[model samples]
Target: MACTLLRRLACLALLALAGCTHSDFRPDYPRVASTVLPVPADAPLAAYATRVTAGHGSDSGLRLISDSNDALLARIALANRAVHSLDLQYYMFHSDATGGLLAQRLLAAADRGVRVRLLLDDLHVAGKDKLLRVLDGHRNIEIRLFNPFLERNASMWGMGKQFAGDFSRLNRRMHNKAMIADGAMAVVGGRNIGDEYFDASEGVNFRDLDVLTVGPVVAQIGQMFDRYWNSEQSYPIGAFHHDTPGPEKLEELRKDMDAHARQFSQGSYAHSLVARVGDLAHEVPGTEWAWGPTTYLADDPDKSNPQADSAGLNMAPQIRAWMDGAQHRLTLISPYFVPGPKGVAYLQGMRERGVAVDVLTNSLASTDAGNVYVAYASYRVALLKSGVQLFELKPDAGRGRHGSHFFGSSSGGNSLHAKAIVVDEEHAFVGSMNLDPRSVHLNTEDGVIVDSHALAQALLAIFADATKPNHAYQVLLDDKDRVYWQGKEPGQPMVRYDTAPQTSWWRRFKVNAGGLLPIESLL
Candidate 1:
């Protein structure tokens, strides 16, 4: 199968180079025997299920995973302790160190007779079909992809073909990320399975946030997983390949994974896992928990379709409810923020009602997505003029932490990737939903709205530290309604930049040039 896929990819590449293409490029991949199993209620995690639910009524016991090490450790701990099933979903899951280690753990769990389910977005799954098929050969493990490309072998060229032949279907993607263990505990937020998400990447560290919850709310998360798993958009790994690994090859794959795990055992990540083994019992029932009701909000799987009638069930409407009901203040943190006219008007209306609106997003220098940044830049003036406080993240914001060797350090750069909102510091929202139109109207998003002021205050504190002058640039409108970035270094004089602070000349030119393009809606 791998050889076959390589041949097809070569053919597609040749065709692409030759400017020869087919209009009917729809892929009719093979399907394998599969079944969507029910989430079991009884598991080892049920022992502490009461602990996480105790005294909180219907609210879940939540802990903020702000540190990358703790975030990775928490997932490892849950995977190790899960006795019944593991349902993992994400938009991006790299085949790097962290992702490989997680796969090793999942394989070990399956060996222990635990059911493992992995669902990932198809956009990033190109060139990984063989690895997925090998994993899917395991009896207890199943791998599926959401809105996958039929041409799985040709990563870039396949995407290009789809873009031209089927733009409407290819444009929408699944951006949700979550990991569930034993149907009792789950982690949901902006972090995907990759080195960058865990601050282990070499070039850039994403300052992200997630919530670890174990309670009744986890059931809803499990249900959300099941819905997407059963949706038509999801396809089993076998659906992409006609051949499956036999027993001998499957054994070889397992041995390879085992060797990889043994190699990782000598690393710091493995040491963290060793220290936190069996710690899930102690992690819950905390006195720090704020007792109140909570709501798990998610968009229907059909929300990916522009014409899908998701109606009030979409995350945008639910999030808007929180934004609309804010009586005093709102703090929004999205890495890719492109507030169109409607968003600007919403914030302005809140300001007119005497509400404070503060926003934090990636700056041009710190942004990894320049096209999205251009769209966001077009709205900065409007947002500022309407009394919206704006702050752009500093590329070097996490340097202190990197130097201290505390938080996970990326290669010499950092950017904000947390998607959260604190409304009046009374209610908090944390999840995969960004404030961009892609998240609001196209991608399926999931988040938990906690009716707890403590959580809100914690998120607010993160926002406060992140918005410091050294970590972020405060955007202000001059008397002439011109834009300028104001920032102050530690124990240094205040400085201002007429252009984006610390941006290169070419980046500035591209941003200015991109602003002229009518791409805000697609951003």
Candidate 2:
């Protein structure tokens, strides 16, 4: 009976694909070309950045934003401080509390004559056309969608049909995340614009990392943004929709968003955040900024094309070079880690060279992507054999605490979302690129490498806090070569689990069954 139902569903899917014409996919749309606006010499942001880096030639200033609320505040502060322009690129931007608050600020900036260019990947913007159209209706704001779907249907069946028709093109995604303010400073890291990323979600929240940078590297980031902004893949949001929302509709959206912001500000969670905005407005001048040589790296936009020479456009090699240069110690923090054979060999080689290697990733119970955990599990024994120290974040890692000095506190389940590498405690890399197949071969990624002992130490401090026994489990191999986990919670005795702890049997079965499939390359 199940097989017959499957057959009927397959037939329906085939018919649906057959019914779709070329117009059902991405259609030819007119897009106007634009470049980054030049930085006005007297702009306040530029002047501030200049004063801070007066003596540091060819070096950038860096500060790590490990707290979720601070991360959101950083972006909001940047948007509010912009006097000339703002360029933002991200994989996902939802319309939740944090997203709406930032959106309201972006609109406020636009109202002040800030040229706002928002570039978002189309995968997550299916039902938000009304909001986007209204924002695009503003003369000072121009929105673009990267690699959009013209059909604008987000249902399960619709996505399946689209995938059946154009699997290769639709599978490729732009995974880069960046926000540049007035061509003077930028923030780059693993965060997306959403409530969970900012600790405002009632459910699961992500512990992420971002670096606010200024000086020479900002120009490099601007150049990279321009390359993507002018690429053939970017389409003006107006091109996808035929009609623009009228002024009345824009005003309606404005009032609704304003009301939401006002209501949110009065809430307990946002009250403290609102109070901190003034300090953030001045870019936190009292905070010590690390000055160092920084190198910005990004995969070319053409990497979104499956037929493109991905190897030549890849940024993984540059990251590998940084890893290859590690001498004393190396640490990796990734949410979804599916290191293939080459990565295993590289880490083993580092171990052989007497470099202590440590890795922190999500455990099965803490991970949002079970398929990825399945693939990552396949190489655990090999990685252990290579003498790589492994730690898996606990599901409730950040619960029951106020904001710590390093990682911020959360009320619900916590998942690792920060992607970074620290080498010899003197250099660090932070950005959206995960150490997995999807980040390497499928999606375009970007990051910055800062050669600063202070920055590296700060990142190492975060790793230290996140990998404590209370916050994470140390993966180990018994004398019989069996995998086990060991950890202890605050005021509790040590515990051991032969299987993934804090997870149900059904979840374990699903992940183990998924491991049997030959889908590692697509992970």
User: Clash totals for all models, in order?
Assistant: 2, 0
| CA error at residue 220 for candidate 2, angstroms | 0.7
Instruction: Encode model 2's per-residue lDDT on 324-414: one tens digit a residue.
Output: 8999999999999999998999999999999999999999989999999989988899999989999999988863354243345557788
Cα lDDT tens digits, model 1, 1-523, are 9999999998776556435333322357554434334444455576677555766666677777777767777788888988878899899988888888788888889989889999998888865767777888898999988877666556566567666555677688898888888877889988999878776677777889988887778888888888888887887877666566887877887898888878878986567656743243355446755555677788888876656676864778878877899999999999999888898888889999999999999999888888899888778888898899999999887545423222344446888788999999999899999999888877888888888878887788788888888878999989999999999888798898898888889988987887888777677
lDDT of predicted model 1: 0.79
User: Ten consecutive residues with minimal summed lDDT in candidate 1?
Assistant: 401-410
- Supply candidate 1's per-residue lDDT for 111: 87
RMSD of candidates 1 onward, in order: 6.2, 2.9
Kindly provide the TM-score of model 2 when superposed on the true structure, using C-alpha atoms: 0.95
